[model samples]
Target: MTDDYIYHVDGDLVPASEATVSVDDRGFRYGDAAFETLRAYGGTILAWDAHLERLERTCEALSLEHGLSAADLRGRIDETLAANDLADAYVRLSITRGVQPGKLTPQPDVEPTVVIYVKPLPRGGLEGDPVWDGPATVETVATRRVPDASIPAAAKTHNYLNGILARVELAADSDEALLCDLEGRIAEGATSNLCFVRDDVIHTPTTDGPVLPGITRDIVLELAREAGMPVREGRYEPADVLEADEAFLTNRTWELRPIATLDGRAIGGGPVTDRLAGLYDDRVENLCYE
Candidate 1:
């Protein structure tokens, strides 16, 4: 039997394959949308409030209205899980400026499109004890992130061409692509936040740059500090990152992934990264939904 999953689009809950939005959808036509990626542990969503809050802020930044209430969206997420019989899953929630005609400008009465998809997290680790598949190799691509002055990085817009291009240019052996900001400083990974270990200190690029302030990034910083690891945030050059003793990337999914190589040059193993990963796991198990 085929295991069919359910998805929610606008106010309709239907089979995943059948869910569709209009071709005129601004998200489809001009990438006018905001989104959030969240994971549910067991039946509870981790950082639901934070994700929802960001979603709201992003929509606001784009002048798109979030017509649904937070409680309403939460209930819909619960329903999606139940319909699909999923206790642990990855969910992508997107809100778009609804169908606009063949025009560049949105109308005054444009409705919003809400879409959420729930899928099994195939590579996701267990609830309490998550495991990584060893260190990953990341390469710096020529594509640079759009500076904050050009487009607000804080808005998780549907415009991911920059990230897509970086991934396209990634080396065949690389697991991810490291992107630079307009200033040639280390910005972040195509899809994750960048962090490095040097002299027993944890360093990450300041969000004052074009980096997206990720929820997991924030949690990792707090966990690192509590574990007595000195955490520093600033603008970092490629040489600094390449010469670092060790480095890792973080995002809502993937959580913590240590970097084995930068442009195929070996970066040594990090005991501090190991310690922080363990602490992050503890925090996920006990403090995730709390």
Candidate 2:
């Protein structure tokens, strides 16, 4: 709250303000970092193990050194929450390619800079009822999600310029932006994974395309399977999403949001979306309290 807590830098707990990395650090200069945003509830971190697994995957994909083991990182997060006196808040865990003075070459001697910050959850539509008030609208932006060839789309890396641009454009017109790949196939939203319901089947873009395998997205898929709904992942076009019976977006922050409209057409949330949204909420409740 007051920014007066300890952060896990290298292997020590340093003051929030004093936890600084060199300006020449590649992460500072070129956005060479990987991070995750976790939610805490009922004095416990939600989905701690899944979040850490994704973080570890990101670090491995980027070839960055994460000095702390999974247990060590979890301990630091627990300590940080206690130090800040926060039970229900958001945790930002970041690891960057450590300080380096030279160009793009990887510096093996520099240890990765790990930072954990706790902040109050932003109050907006996120806490409202699970059912969307109206049809969720989507805006097509000029920017496209990064192609797999450029950077593996599955990893949650610091390179987010494309997503930032899409978000800016969407904020001006609609609640979220729908992104397409270079080939014009619907990739995903700026920050969340896209899911559509048609004929009681749930469909999402495949990892082979330009889409982040969101933690929340994975949960929804599991929930759908447990509920006996057919779910598949494959290439889909914006038109396909528009024509679906129901559509929604999923992410850690939003959980599951029903889509009401695409472009200007009215597309109400389908029974599948509604049921899945409820199921996802129940999962969250259990994770937060259990």
TM-score of each: 0.94, 0.88
Q: Score residue 91 of candidate 2 by CA lDDT.
A: 82
Locate the minimum summed-lDDT window of 10 residues in model 2.
122-131
Q: Across residues 76-137, which tens digit of lDDT does each residue of candidate 1 receive?
A: 88888888888767888888888878898777675889888888754333244343466778
Which residue pairs clash in candidate 2? 135-260, 136-260
User: Candidate 2 clash total?
Assistant: 2
TM-score of model number 2: 0.88
**Predicted candidate 2 versus true structure: per-residue lDDT over 19-93, tens digit per residue:** 877787677888889999887765677678889888888888888876778887888788877777777667888
In candidate 2, which residue ranges exceed 4 Å CA deviation? Answer: 1-20, 122-136
lDDT of 1 at 286: 69
